[model samples]
Target chain A: MDVQAFKQRILPVQGRLFRVAQLFLRNREEAEDALQDVMLRLWSNRQQLETYQSLEALAVQMTRNLCLDKLKAHSRQKMATDGDFPEVQATTATPYQQVEAADSNELIHRLMEELPDQQRFILHLRDVEEYSFEEIEQLTGLSVNNIRVILSRARQRLRDSYTKANDYEADY
Target chain B: MKPTIEKLLEKYYDGETTLDEEKELRAYFQQENIPAHLQSHAPQFRYFANARSEHPSLKSINALANRLNAPEPNWVVRMGSWSVRLAASIGLLILGFGGGLVYNQLRPSAGKGTDLSFISETAPEKSLKQTLAFEQLAKTSASERIDAINQSYEITQADQEITQLLLNTLNFDSNVNVRLAACQALARFEREPSVRDGLIQSLKVQTDPNVQITLIDVLVTIKERRAVEEMQRLAENQEALDAVRLKAEEGVQSLNQAGNAPS
Candidate 1:
């Protein structure tokens, strides 16, 4: 793949790739960095790019792996510095007033952020990105049936939390 | 039609809905007059619709493309393996020695009292980290800049320079998340008069819903009464998204209530 071909083929999928990165990283800046790294890696391996059946799937997989690596590195650093300043952690905690005042959209966003990482990522790919089970399997290396099960669990979890939160709000 | 929609919702939770079925569900939820029975599900679908629009900036993409399109240096590729290894080791040695020399010079003399010496040892390290973080904020990659802001948490003391940089980021950073992080970081220095004024000013310029919401949250948390008018402006801005406007309105109400309460 020449530079022009690479741009034509890969640049268009950056939005999808970036969404995957953000789903995992939960930070736009980190996701943008991950997207750039994925693109650069794909370009360096452009000679073998055509061998893949799905370039978009390849890009998503690379993004997911890069985000996982970043998460791992972040956790490792956290562990090394554990207990150094517990008060500092408390500063970022959501103010209680905000919780009482959260709108439905904010409530749902918080619920989504609280989902398990695997479930959240699958939910994002299926519902937000609208990837098919087969496409998701290709990207995640999970079986199609496994993907369906996980996606079901994710959807159900969101529904459960959304309803529970609304019910709590209704009581007030 | 309601029965069909209910059936599709069941399939959606079971992960059996086809892409088209999911689209139909999204469209149904997007309507303003969704029945109360189905209203709870609307936010999730709305979230999905919003998430679909999340994307990186075109400027960053173009920058990455240009960087990759640039010609690679042939000399490095042409170097022999042994020569490359030798050169790398020599580079590392110089860097190590030079870093050690700088550290020694930066370290305070050891003969002082233990408490004073301890404070001096940490003082330089904090400033060094602050300097590195300030430099990182100028880099093109938003991630590098965020990392720089994260480093500011370690400095303990509220340096005027870092506060100004963060305020600048909150007002002007191209990435919403970067600006949001800056807002959160600034909350640590909420007591500073300048920081409070900067945040109140930021409420006027921020248009992104997420950042606007966060700025309001931070301002509210710090009980910045001055922010109430700015929040009222955002609340009345017709162009603002419903969520942002609602948040601003709520912020105004809360700030006003707090002001009225006898301390």
Candidate 2:
């Protein structure tokens, strides 16, 4: 495909690709690099890009694979040892409530980090990006039922972890 | 949490919720007024919504596009071959002209310069072969090619090759410094109509503000009345750099004055 065609077709989906990368790698710079690399690969293959059923799904799949290939072991190690995932602000609460809100935000990210990679990615695609089950299935090469099961398990795991953290905080 | 939301949340974590029900669960958690016990789950919904807002920079997007969509390999190979042939022919033409100029310089007393006759008598076929050899050097050293063009500039009174090189350089060289230097050299040969036209054309297409301003300055100094309209258009363009617009405005005024004055 020519550049303008590629830009119109694929460039607009970069944010989704970046977010997926961020979800997988949990580092903004690493995610940015992964997205850039994926975009370059997509561009080189643009001549055949249009034949794909969903460019967005393909891009997301590429970003996921790139980040998964290079995700740092230390990040996984850090999550287990320190429960530190990068800071993410998910609320517009007042400063009075922001401390509590931010704590939960970090907790959610950490919980996801602790989940199995497939479950984490499945939940992210469905919950965050809001891709349909069929779309997620096509991207992930999983059945719709498998996606539902993984996402359900991922949410339950998140709830269990959040409860444990809350209990620990209360004990302190 | 509301009883309905409680039911949806339960269905949500049980692998039994439909997409719509899951969205409802997400919406319920997104609110600020969820029961304190369920507040920790709010971020999971919030993360999804916030992550959607992430955007990579436009610079990275364009860089990827440029790198990946570079000219096709066959086109590059074809252009390389064409350029080599063109450069070879141009080199021979310049060498033949340079030899004639040197011969003229040595033969001030016509037919009295026997010492250098052998050098000037090199066969045209040999020069063609030498030109092919020089073409190899030209591909290796762009600086050498530029130097050859510069040497041609010295003999501009005899031919158009120098002006052609200068015009090509001004219009197409990727290096701003080379184009800037070419603009300066073109000023010396402003008597050439091609140089005058090239300056105006370059003004219209050149992206560099420095080159635009220089082209305007040269056109104004030469009083090329034809450039006034292009300069006016450039001056009025909002996207043109401030200095370039100002220089273009000045060029139009000076060209108008030069037009009104009697010879």
Query: Per-residue lDDT of B103-202 in model 1, one digit per residue for the tens?
Result: 7876645434656746654554344345335444465577766776676677677867668878988888777877888899899998889999999988
lDDT of 1 at B92: 100
Candidate RMSDs in order? 47.6, 34.4
Cα error, candidate 2, residue B2 (Å) = 2.0
Model 1, range A1-172, lDDT digits (tens) per residue?
8778888999889999988887777666777899999998998899999999999988888999998999988763211211121222223335662233235545666788779988998899999999988888887889988988899999999999989988887897
Which is the leading candidate under DockQ? Answer: 2
**TM-score of each prediction:** 0.50, 0.53
Candidate 1: list runs displaced more than 4 Å: A76-102, B71-263
| Candidate 2 docking quality: incorrect, acceptable, medium or high | acceptable
DockQ of each: 0.28, 0.35
Interface RMSD of 2: 2.3
What share of the reference contacts survives in each candidate?
A: 0.75, 0.70
Q: lDDT tens string, model 2, A1-172? A: 7767887888788888987887777766666788889988887787788789889988888888888778653445332312222334444667666676656666676777889989888888887777888898899899888888888898899888888887898898
